[model samples]
Target: MKQWNIGVYFSLRFQEIAGALDSALAVPILVPVQSSHSDENSQDLTLKQSVTLLESLRSCWSEDVLLISCADKFLRLSLQLLSRYSNWLSSGLADWKKGSVSSNPGCEWAISALPDDFIIHDINWLAKRICGDYLEGILQLLSTCSTEVLDLVKKSILHGGKSLSDLLPSVINTIIEALVDKSVEDLRQLKGITATYRMTNKPLPVRHSPYVAGILRPLKIAGCSRWRTSNNIFDRRC
Candidate 1:
């Protein structure tokens, strides 16, 4: 089996779409923050650099989905690092305040505050900055993935269990339904071609049944389109 770097694939796909768009906005490349477990000092430095990059890109905010993608790849590393940094700032401010009284207290206080001159490092603010529209650009990106990559995603979801489903938008169910319908249509076409080839003793064109089957099997296994339907029956008797 081949290993796929889903994070890189997702970022590249997002960039490709952003480039084709008419707007001047570009998707910002969010580098995942490193964990503090390995080299705390270096991790802190990298975290600061990531923060600086985000600040620079704030003016051209395209979608918070990009940040969500980063969080998905990095898991709790990004959140934990940011939270620790914020606490560090608060503790440092307290120490500074106890040690010396600045001649200009207002300026000093404003400079020391977390949200005053920087992104609020809390989870809620981070969510606002990273998931503002709530999976707006995500579906677009997911639709563009190649069938092979989609298969890999399906496997990952299965191995990781259903909890991963919460990370996906409800709109994905509709997309899956469309995919299954298309696959069924393709299979029908392939069957017709196979029948024609058998009768005429001519070689059939390359069959895409396998590819379509590969795509649909995982979707069915994952229950991507499991929804209930109801038919209304009304009768009036006077």
Candidate 2:
């Protein structure tokens, strides 16, 4: 009888698992769901399988396994899978407070089970992956992320192994976009609440006096003017 090599067995099994994930994640980007019924169905099936496999892998994770030489492959695969399924995971997160069931329960479970170090690694990988071609989509994704994720992304960009000079333009664009989005959101919320008060014939909360608003208006305008001038300069540089 031949003796079994336990080490070889585990190595082969790990490779098989990683290969399965690689195949699942190889699905090509299809046309918009509205444009191609068959492609949409195929994409959905691929994502479902990927999410299922991800949860299975998460269940098997341990400190010992994570220390293995092949673990980086698993980590890269996990990050790619997470990025693809981020929308599903984020939607699930919003339902946590309401005790509502998630649409993608497996994704929610897998994401919640990920270690903090893994999360940080994933964020760093994503930061390094961003490029001019994918800047808009990546920024949109990051903008909707939690503060913890955002902070990690910033740290990765500023302190990670990349050259700062090469990333300056992308960094500038990201900051401008984030600032603009935040300002717009704040203004929208303020206008919405004030409008609601007007509709209900209720007096608005008196946090700031009318004199304060008068003083702030010119300052706000000046800030906007400065931003516009800077934006013009950015456009010229680009």
Candidate 3:
């Protein structure tokens, strides 16, 4: 028997994360839907727009965010369900994989926040299998947009169990390679710096924590106004 070891991490502030996301995404979604209600033909057109916007917003979120640490109960539960879902997905016999847990409230927040979109009534009646299908479809749509998105799909698969940093370099490299047209030598240098810093055995620098905080800020947002004019990664929208 092949044992697929999934190292699950649980983290606190899960609701806080969800709350921040809902706040950021909900309003931009509502406008198109509200405009659609006035006329029949225009309603249909606006409704489609609303659906796309909502779907995109929902799809933008990485499920991996919820799985950040080993202490999160919800994350553990989600993974257990996902493991079953993945197995079912791999099985050709099953038309769909069923998740024991419902992530529908997240989906509903997405849907109600954009009501003009066609409301599939009785959504509650759909089997867990169908919800899995919905998530699968949403992820599939996101995968086509950029190398960054494709790397996310790859991580979701390979990340059945792994440290987050273990995946960061590959993803960053993919984004840079696909969007920036960087050469292999440039990439190797970047990866080398990341690995040396991350894997070093030293006690860490006096500025280590802040240095990490600094690294997280997108280069353009880091107040190098001079460089922003020439290499505006912020505008790239990756």
Candidate 4:
């Protein structure tokens, strides 16, 4: 059994999992749900399914019959999966750049103070849920394994042994800042809000600001509390 895990079968399974991640995460995830909501998410679930497909092999260790390390397999496999997600995000950010970022100079700072723009809700959710929450969870899972397994898996990925502080935070920040840049770029109607007060000499209306509300509909659909953007990923709080 250990031989199977350490040899041809393991290699085949690893390729299959990498293929699964490509199939699942490659397309542009255009938008999140519009109305109803559920905690059961297919994106993260796809990641979990890929992990469990191999993690289940841990059964071999219990009988003292396993010489292979499941931890090594898990780390490599998880990195393979995240590589797919990171690629997809790279594409999105690139596409956004061609159409959005070059036009805006303050992209680096805009993400720090972006409005609750709806166009980027899906991007926001993925970065927050998958990269933020899910990656943290994956790290915790690795902590359960022996250091030998962790050390071995490091060779499987670039910067696999470096402190996350030295790597991931900047990458995540760039993607988010790009998304925020796109969101802020879409605020064409913003001038109209002030125009209503400037053009009209009539008394101030008591009703809620329609133009502002229209701009915030994405927040309404996604929920005000659910939306969050990071000014500084280097601060390690996304």
Q: Count the backbone clashes (under 3 Å) in each candidate.
A: 1, 0, 7, 0
lDDT of 3 at 114: 17
Query: Which portions of model 1 show Cα errors greater than 4 Å?
Result: 1-73, 100-128, 131-238
Screening candidate 3 with a backbone cut-off below 3 angstroms (N, C-alpha, C), the clashing residue pairs are 9-69, 9-70, 10-69, 10-70, 10-71, 10-72, 11-72
Best by TM-score: 4
Q: Can you tell me which runs of candidate 4 are displaced by over 4 Å?
A: 1-7, 28-78, 100-209, 224-238
Better of 2 and 4 by TM-score: 4
The residue pairs that clash in candidate 2, if any, are: none
TM value for model 3: 0.20
Candidate 2 lDDT, 1-238, residue by residue in tens: 1476655755675666555554543333211112122332122221333334444344224444443343334445444444444433343334433345455433343333211122222233334443232233323444666778556644443332233233334334433443454455445445566667778977767685344455445446546755654454344344
- Please give each candidate's TM-score: 0.22, 0.22, 0.20, 0.41
Instruction: For candidate 3, give the lDDT.
Output: 0.34
What is the full ranking by lDDT, best candidate first?
4, 2, 1, 3
Runs with alpha carbons beyond 4 Å of true place in candidate 2: 1-3, 30-46, 59-238
Worst 10 residues of 1 by lDDT: 229-238
Candidate 2, residue 115: Cα displacement in angstroms equals 26
Error of 2 at 3 (Å): 4.9
Error of 3 at 104 (Å): 19
